[model samples]
Target: MSSAKVWTIAETSGRRLKPVSYELPARGRMLADKLGTRLASVVIGDQVDRNDLQELFWRGVDEIYLVTHPELAGFLVENYSNVLIALIKTYRPEIIIAAATTTGRTLMPHVAVRLPAGLTADCTELDIEEETGNLLQTRPAIGGNILATIKTPHHRPQMATVRPKSTKPLPRDESRSGLIHIVKFNPNWIDGRVKKVGMRQIEETGAGIQDTDVVIAGGKGLKKGENFSLLRELAMLLGGVVGASREAVDRGWISYPHQVGLSGKTVTPKLYLAAGISGAIQHLAGMKTAEVIVAVNSDPEAPIFKVADFGIVGDLFTVLPAFISRLKGGKAK
Candidate 1:
């Protein structure tokens, strides 16, 4: 067997690769370099384009394990886990990481329980411990009030599912190269018990909060559900999406999909505007990576100001209307 390696699972939506697939290798590459091991990425799907798989090399993977079969078109836990277990047993990786998406969250746990290894979920950060060389996995704990770091000392393959958007993908390097090994599909891996019935796509209006470049987020300070209209108007003016803090979601001011925090979606927008959000650590964990942050809060001492590129210490109702008016080429009343 080859020396213990660091591995990242590439996530796909049909034939297209997801963004987190590249992001994982960027971080995994760093960990692999620090641990003196090679970084390998696994892609399992039917008819995934070779050009798309090549992006893994540009993102700093030393090898690409491509497993394809007609039955692998859609994700089924039973079949996917069977294939993954076989690879793990053969390669014997020292570390395994996947995105904390619906597929990853479900697959990793299934693989871990079968391998009987310790697994961490939704890690925001990962590092290598110098003294022991254990993979340090950091995640929010205790209702998102604190961060906890965990290690799998007894396990051969340390496993974790990292939250999407927690880290940015590395700049692509076309000169980088790696080996592509095609793993033969085993029909026996398919489970007779379960079958993929059909897939449904949910239609949504406008861009999703996670995909938008600019995000205007609200919090408890917005006062009521109707006040979210203020944020929607501003978002429309800015050509962005509206996001909300968990507090606002819990109060039924907004739907859960619009919520941004540790328990919610992690977003890396080009510009993030926080209107009336106090900036709890959990909320900060979600959008701290925004290229430019503008915060509006009445309190000068609000934590949001600390991370904001531009801070306005004033009421959101007053500040937001002024912003909307200016964007519309009209003077603030």
Candidate 2:
């Protein structure tokens, strides 16, 4: 082996690269530079666009490991893990990072066990320790009330899954250059135990909260599940999606997909409207990165006001209808 390098697993949907694929290299490049190592990205799919793969180099990766085969079209944990394990054994990277999406949450643990390496999941932050060169993984712990930093000092490959949208991708630099190495697929690596039959696509009302430019989120102060309808209406008027704090989701006011917090999806919308939320640290962790934060709470001392670009001190029931009325071209009392 020449030297230990940093690796980022590229995530793809169909033949297109996911946004997090670029985000990984942006972050990985920083860590690699800190460790005085090279940054590489592993891309696996069938007939994936070469142009999409090349963008990784523009983002920051110094090397690309491309694995393409008909059998690899659909992601099977067994097949993907086998391929990754084989590559790891050969390259022996010092660090590996993947997005904490569905594929990553499922695949990383399986690969970690097979490689017998320590793994961290849903990390909010990653850093390189100066003296030890350990990958520092930070995540919310104890019900998202506190943050914990972990390190795999004894492991060969420091593995971590980072939450999507936790950080921004680096600006593309067309001047950057890298080499792509084609990795051969092994037929025997495919296991008969698991097979992909089909994939189902669920119909959603509008764009996902994560993808929307505006987000209207409610919390425990909304009082009941029915009250979430007000949020839905406001979201509709704003051409956005409705999101819920953990408390509202816990109360069954909305589905988990609409949740925004440390335990849920991280959103970086252009405008985030929080209603009846006290702004716990966990909830803030997810939406604080929004360009503009507007909070509405009855309590003048609510923590949400601390981060809000605009704050309103009033009962949500009274305040919401006024907003709805104004947006509808009706005069507000």
Candidate 1 lDDT, tens digit per residue, 1-333?
345299999988889898889989977998999999889999999999888888889988889888999889878899999999999988899999998888998999999999988899978789999999899999876645578999999897999988666667889999998888789999998886887787654342222776677899999899999999998998888889999999999998888888897888877778899998999988998888778999999999999999999999999888888788888886645
| Model 2 TM | 0.82
lDDT per residue (tens digit) for residues 169-208 in model 2: 7899999888888998899768869777776554444226
Q: Candidates' TM-scores?
A: 0.82, 0.82
Best by lDDT: 1
What lDDT would each prediction earn against the true structure? Answer: 0.87, 0.86
**Model 1 CA RMSD to the hidden true structure, in angstroms:** 3.8
Q: How much is 260 displaced in model 2, in angstroms?
A: 4.0
User: What pairs collide in candidate 2?
Assistant: none
